[model samples]
Target: MFSATVLWLLLAPAAVSAAPLTALTDCLTSSAVPQLLTTNSKYALAIKPFNLRLPFTPAAVAQPTTVAQVQAAIACGVAQNFTVTPKSGGHSYASHGLGGENGHLMVDMKYWTNVTVDSSTQIATIGVGSRLGNVAQALYSQGGRAISHGTCPGVGIGGHVAGGGYGYISHTQGLAMDNLVGAQMVLANGTVATLSATENPDLFWAIRGAGASFGIITYYKFQTFAAPNSNIVYSYNIQFTAANYLALQNYANTTMPAEMNMRMFITSGGLQLEGIYYGSQSAFQAAISPILSQVGNPYGSTSTMGWIQGLSNYAYMSLTTPIDYDIFSKSLMTVAVTPAAAAAFVAYYQNTARTVSRDWYLIIDLHGGPTSAISKVPMDSTSYAHRNALFKYEFYDRVDSGSYPSTGFSFLNGWVASLVNARKKRGQKADGCKVPTTTFGMYINYADSSLTADQAHNSYWLTHYARLSAIKKSVDPNQVFSNPQAINSK
Candidate 1:
C-alpha cells in the first residue's frame, strides 16, 4: 500500500515535517499555506479553548486537499506520540476540537471545501470543510435546497452533520444528520475510510449523531430537496404575557401542513411562531393564517428571495453578514456553554431579560418536505435519532458584552432558565425531554454543550447507549478522543 507520508510529500511538500517547532513556521513548507488561512496564521493554528482555553499549542498546522494528506497528518501525530485535532471551521464551543498546548498538530480542513451535485441520485457530496452558504448556492443552482442550520452560515459540514444539524427547514426536512447518505473519515489509527448505509454500516450508524467521538469526517453525501419558489417571510412575533403559551403551541402543533414549515417559541415577549413554505403567496397565506389568527398580533417582514437570500435574512445582527457567500458558510465558531449553575442560571438570565426587554425571543423553523422522512432503517441504524420533529427551536441573546456584559450575561441566563423552567413545569426530568421516548427527542447538534453524559444519553437514543458505548470501546478503547462532550468509554 502507498504510504500516507509518501503521498503527502508528493502533494503538499510544505506539510512534510522532520522536526517540530514552537510555532507553525518551524513545520509548514507549502505554497498553498497562504491560500488556506486567515491573517493570524499561527494563532489560528492553536487550539486554545475547549469550554475554556487549555495550556497547549499545536506544533504546526497543515491544510491538506485530499484525504491522503489528512491520513498523513494523523500518521505523523501517531508516530510522534502527539495528539491531532482536525478542524474545518473553528466553530466548536467545547474543547472537543482544541489540540491543547502539548498538541502535535492541528489538521486544517478548509482546503477540502468542495461540493459536487449528483443529479443522478439527488445527492450532494460535500467536503467536510464546506460551509452551508456554498452548499446552499450549489444546490440552488441545481434547482434544489437542503434542510440545514438556520443562522450562522460559516459552520463546517463535518461538525454540523456530526451533531445532527438543525435549520429553518428542520420542521420540514428534519436534522442535518438525518439527511446524510455517506461519509469519508480518517480513523484515529490513520486509516482513510468511507462509511455509508450500504457499506460500513456500524461506523455509519455511530458517526451520524456522535461523529466527533468517532473520527475526522472528510466529506459527507447529503440528500437534497427541491428548491422553494417563494421567498422567506422573516417574522418576529412579540408577546409579553405567558397567557399565549398554549394558544401558540396548539396552533403550531395543528396548523403545520407538510407543505408549510412552522417554528414556535415561548419567549420573554410571550409566544412567537415563525415559518417558511414551498408555495405561492396565496398558499403561504393559507398555511400561516391559523397562526396569525391564533396570536392576533403584528409581525416583522415578508419578502420573496432566492433560497440562499432567505438564509441571509436570518443572520444575527451581532455578526457581520458575510458579503462573500462562502465566507459566511463557516458557521459554528464559539461553542461556549451556559454556566453549570442551572437554577441561579435560570433565575438571573430568564426573568431579567423579560424585565429588561420585550423583544427576547425563541426562534423556530419549519422545513423538510417530501424528502424529510425517517429512514426505514431501524433507529439504531443511524446516529441521528430525531427524525420526526417538524420544527427546530433556537433561543438566542443579542446583547453585546463590551457595551453591556451585564445585559448579555442576563440574556443568556434568562434564555437558559426559560427553557429549563418550561421543561420542568411540563414535568420533564433533568435528563429527559418532556416528549415521549417513542416519538420526540433532542437534536444532537442543538444539544447544549454543557449537557452531562446521562443527560445526553437520556435525551437522545437512551436504549442505544449500551450499543454506542460498545462501539466507542471497540474503535477508541483508550479514549484518546476524550473531551467534555465525548461518549464515556467505560
Candidate 2:
C-alpha cells in the first residue's frame, strides 16, 4: 500500500467541497451523459482514488460515453471556471485522477474503451479507458502484435505511455511513447483534435510526457510489433555484495543486450532477479554469464512461454479492480551510479530492511546500453526526458490501515538520499544533506506528490521542463486541466 504525504482519510466529498454549482450541474446534465454530484449515492466511490491513503471529493464526476460528450464535459468545466480532470482507470499514484487536491470537475473515461487494430498496418488504436492488459490482449488476439509498456496489467494507457512506459520489452523496443505514432484528444479549450508529427505537432511533442497537464487524451495509436512467439523467463535470488552490485550495474549499462531485460527486487533476504528474455534459452544463458561470474553463480528458475503467457507472469490485477492499501512511492532515474554511491545504497538497504515498520520493497530496473532503444533516442526528440538514465529505482511501501506513519516518509526518502548524497560536494561548509548535484532524479509515473511545483518540474523533465512550460502556456492558457504537480501555466 502507498499514500500521499498528506492524508485525508474517509472524508466525505460534501464535507470537503462547497455547495454544488447549479450552472455546472445543468451544463453536464444537458450533455445527456450520466453525472454524479457530491451528494449522489455513487459519488464517494466515483471519487475514490486508487491509492486509498488519499481520498478527495471532486466538484463533480462527468461520465462521458462519447468523444463529443467528453468535449461537453470540458466545455462545462471551462464555462464554470472549474479545474478539469480526466479519470482513466483511476490509477494515478498521486490520485491526480481525483484532481490531486480537490474540487475539480472529474471526467470519468470508463465508457471510452474501444480497441481496434488496423488491418493493413497492424497499428493499434486504444481508447483512454483501456488498461494495459486489455490493450495487450486486444492487439495480440487481433494480429499477434504488441507494444513496449510497463508490466502492470491495470495501468491506464492514458498516463502510462504519456509518462514514458518502461517494461520487459523496453530495452529493445523502446518505451510505449517511443512506438506511439498518434492520438486523438480534447484540448483544454474543448477542441477535439488529432495528434501526430504532421498534425498538431507541438501538442504531439507535449503529449509524449506532459499530456495530462495540457489536455485529456481520448484515444492513443501505437505503432505495433509482431509479438514474440516464445520467450525465456527466469528468476534468481542472491545476497549480493557491494562489488557484485557494481558489477551487475555496470553490466546493465554497458553490456546488457536489447534482446534481454531484467530487474532486481530487494527483499529482506536478498535481491530477487527476475526478467523475460526475448530470445532463446541458449542465447539467454550466454548473455547472463557475466552476472553469474560477478555474483558467484546463484542458480534460479528459467522456463519458456508464449507471448501472452509471459505477460500474465507479470500481471497482478484486473483493469477495473481497486486495490485497497495506503500506498506511498518514490522513484529515481539516474544517468549513472558511482562506485561510492552503489556501496552506500547497498549498506543503507541492508540496515533499513530489518527495521522498516511497513511492508516495503525496492525495485531496481536496468536501463541504457550501447544498443538500447531507449538510450539511442535523442533526449530532445520528446518531452519525456531521461534517455540517458542508466537505471530506475522505484521505492514502494504500504500500510494496511490508518494514516501513513510519520516515520514511513523518511525511510524511503532517506534511502534515496543515501545514494545521491553518497558523493558529497567538494566545498561544503559543514556536513549536510544538501549536495551540489543529485546523481538521481524522479519518474512521473511513480510520482512523488510531496515535492513542490519547482522541484517536480525539474525532477521529471530536467531541461525539457522549460519547453513543456512554454507549450503548457500556449495550449492551455486558461488552465482548464490541472492537479497539484501538473505543469501550471504562468
Candidate 3:
C-alpha cells in the first residue's frame, strides 16, 4: 500500500530531484513523444485558453494523436513529477485546461477528434477533442441523431460533457452528461480505463461531473436521440422593458412547456425573452399564447428552420467575435426569479451599462417540465447535484484585455457577485416543481474563479461532495489532477 507521503513523492514534481526537469524536457522533445508544443512554438498559443482572464502558461503543451500518446504524456508527467492538465476545447473559464496557474504540463486533445456513429444503437463515440459543432454535424449527418450539449459550438466534449453540459434542448433530452453511456479515460497513474454504468461505476460517476480532477478523458460514448422530424424549430424573441421582466418570469414559471426552451437575456438595451420551441409553429404559438397575451405590444418575431440550421444560427462562435477579453463569470440555480431580484438586476444592469464601457449580460435558462428528465435521476446517482433546479442563471461581463484599470476589473467582478447574492436573498428553493425548501444551488461547468475550494465544492456537488471526494481519493490519491476548484482526495 502506498502511504500519502510516498504518493506525493511519486506524483509531485517538487518532491523529485531538479535533474528530472531537464530530462522531462528532453523526453518531451524526442520522437518518443509526438506533437508536443513547447512555450516557444507557434502552436503554443493554440493551447492558450479561451478565457483570457487568467493568462496561465503551461511549461509545455502535448498534442497527442492517439490514446497511447495520451498515456505517454501522463507517464512522462508522473515520472518527471510535473503537474499535467488535459486541454480539450480550451474553454475553461478559469483556464484550468492551461494548467490553471503556470509551468505545468498540458496535454492538448485537439488533434484527437474523431466521431463514429453506430446506426443501429444510435450511439455516437466522440473523441474528447471533438468540439460541440463537430459532434453535432457528425451525428446529424451520419445518424440523424442529437444529444443535449452546450450552446457554444467550439466547446470541447472533454470538459463540456464531463462538467454536466446543458443547452437549448436539454430541457427535453436532459444534459449532455446525462446522455453519457460510457467513456475512455487515462487515470492519474498513466493507466487507461474504460468507464460506464457497469464498468468502474464509481469512477464513472465521478467523471460524469468532476472529470478533470480524476483523469484525462479520451473519448465519450453517448446514447443519442433521433432528430425531431421536419427538423423544424420555432424561435420567438420578445423585447420588453425592465418593468416587464417579472411578468416574463411568471409566465416562464407557470405556462412554459418543457419542449420549448426560454432564455431571458438582460442586456444594456433592455430585457429580451427568447423562446425556442421544438415542434410546429401552431404548437409553438399555442404553448406561448399565455405569455403573449400578458405582454401587450411587445416587439417580437417567430421563425422556423432545420435543426442543424437552427444550431448554426444559435452557435455561440458565430454570435460572438474572437477577441481576447478579460472576463468574470458566475452562476446560480434558483426556483424562480422573484420580483425583487428581477428589479434589483434591472437597476444594476442599467447603471453599469450606462456608466462603464465594458460589455455585460445576464442569461437565464428555464429548467423543469415534462421534457426535463433531470429529476428522473436521483441527485446522488451522479456528481451533478442540481437535478432539481428550476432555472440556471449565468452572469458574464467582459472588457478588452489590458483595457480595464485595476479598479475597473474589481468593479466588474463585484457587480457579477452582487447579482447572484441579490437572487440568493430573495429566491426560494423548490425541488423540481416540489414545495419550496431553501435557496437554490450552482452549476459546475460555469466554474467561478472567485470561489474558494470549499465554496466551489459546496456549490457544485453539495451533498455529493463526500462521495466525489472518496472517488477522487480512490482514483487520484496523489492529487495529480488538481486546480483551484478540483475535487480534493482529503
Candidate 4:
C-alpha cells in the first residue's frame, strides 16, 4: 500500500510545469526572483552574492525532497529537452555541478538532507545534500561517527562520494568511498535504483568511486562505527622553518605511530601540524615526543577534548569554524609552503591573485584513526585504484572571470608542475628511498577539473583514466552525468 501511494505521488500531475526553459519565467514560477534565488541556490552561489558566476544562467532550479521527487525532476528535465546539473553542496570550482553553458536545469539536493542510523545493521543512511558538519554533530551525539571528511564541513556527501571523498581519517579508513554500503540514485531516464554490494554489484562498484557521471543520487547508506568516548589530546599550530619541513615530511613518512592522527600543513606563512591521540595525554606525548623533538620547541599548548570537540579544535587550528557555510563556500585553497618557501609562492600567488584567473593552492592532510580502515576490496572493483594510502592532497585559488591572465595562469600551473616533477625525480631511485606508487595516487576529490584528458590519465600513480573510463562506461552508458572532470563516455 505504501509503495502504491508513493507511485501515485510520483505520478501526480507534475506540480511543476514540464515546459522547455525558453525564458527565465519558465523556471521562476513566482514573480519573486530574489526570494527564489535566496531560498534555492546552493551555499557557494548564495554566500558570495557578488561572485562572477557563469555566463549562462539556469532557467530553473528544482529542490527535491525525496527519491521520487528527484526522479520527477529528472523526468521533467528530459521532457523539457533541457540539460540538467546536480548540486549537492556546490563545492565544485567548475560550473559542472550547476547548470551553466547549455545546461538549463539544476537539481538542488539540499532539501533532501537527512541522516539516520540503522541500529540493527549499523549503517547510516545519509541524504545526498547532507554536509559533513551536520553528519559529524549528529553521529557524535548518538555515539556514532564517520571517518574524517573535508575540514569545512559544508561539502555535500553526494559529490564527495562520487568524486572519492577523503579526509583526515583517509590514511586510516581509506577513502570515504570505502565506507559507502549502498545508495539510491535517480537515473537520467528517471528510473530510481538502489545499489549495494550484494545487489547490483556492478553499479555499486561504479558509484563507490565514479558515481557522478551516472545519475542524480538521492540518498546513500554507509557502514558506521561507534563514536570514540575519550577526550584525546590534540597538538595543533602553524610554526616551522623550511629546514624542519624535510624532517617533518620524513617523520610523516615513517615516525607517526598508528595511535596518533597526524597531519601537516605548509603554506607561505610556515608549517602547521595537527595531531590527535586516541589515548590519554601522556600516551600521546610519549608516542609523538620523537617527532616533536625535531621542532626544538615545546608545543604551544595541548588541549584535551572529546572526539567532537577535537574536530572543532582541528577546525580552529586550520583557521576554519565548523558549519560556517558562507566562509566555507569561499575558502577553497590549501597548499603547503614554509617561510623560506613563501617568497617564491607569493611571487606566483600575488601576481595570480591580481589577475583574473581561478587557481588555488591545497595542502595534503594525512590524519586517520583506526576508524578509517583502508579498503580490503579488490583493486579493480571500482575505478579508484589506490589501495594503501596515507594522505590525500588538494589545493585551490579563485579567480574572477574577466580578470584572469592566461599566461600567468599557465605559469603558475607550470611552476607547480615543475616542483612536482622535481620531487618525482628525486624519489625515482629504485632501490633506496623508493616512493610507494600505491601511496603516490592523487585524491580524486581534489583533482583539478581543468586538467586535460592526458593529464588526468597520467597524474595518478596507481589508477589510470582507461580503467576509470571503463567503469564510467559500465555505469553510465549514455554519459548523462557528464562533466569536465568526469570520465568521457564513448
lDDT of 3 by residue, 317-392 (tens): 6622333456777777765666766666667666665566568777877765434566556768888887777778
lDDT of all the models against the reference? 0.56, 0.81, 0.73, 0.56
RMSD of 4: 9.5
On the 0 to 100 scale, the lDDT of residue 410 in model 4 is 58
In order of appearance, the predictions have TM-scores of 0.73, 0.93, 0.86, 0.74
Best by lDDT: 2
| Model 2 agreement with the true structure over 1-490: per-residue lDDT tens digits | 4233223443434433344467788888887757977667776667767777667777778988887888889988898889999888787778988888768888988776898999798888889888888888888989798999888887888888778889988988999999999999898777888999999898899888878888889999988999997689888886756787777778877778888888888866678888898988899999988777788788799999998889888775653344656778899987766788778888888787557757888888887767689989888888988888878889998876666776678888888888877755422448554554433568888888777877788888888888888888888877888888888622
Model 3 worst lDDT window (10 residues) = 7-16
Candidate order by lDDT, decreasing, is 2, 3, 4, 1
Q: Candidate 3: which stretches are off by over 4 Å? A: 1-20, 29-31, 35-40, 229-253, 316-324, 369-371, 409-440
Question: TM-score-based ranking, best first?
Answer: 2, 3, 4, 1
**Which candidate gets the maximum TM-score versus the true structure?**
2
Better of 3 and 4 by lDDT: 3
Poorly placed runs, candidate 1 (over 4 Å)? 1-42, 45-59, 99-104, 143-149, 232-236, 264-272, 297-301, 316-350, 356-361, 364-381, 387-392, 397-462
> How much RMSD separates candidate 2 from the native structure?
3.2
C-alpha lDDT of candidate 3 relative to the true structure: 0.73
Please give the TM-score that candidate 4 achieves against the real structure.
Answer: 0.74
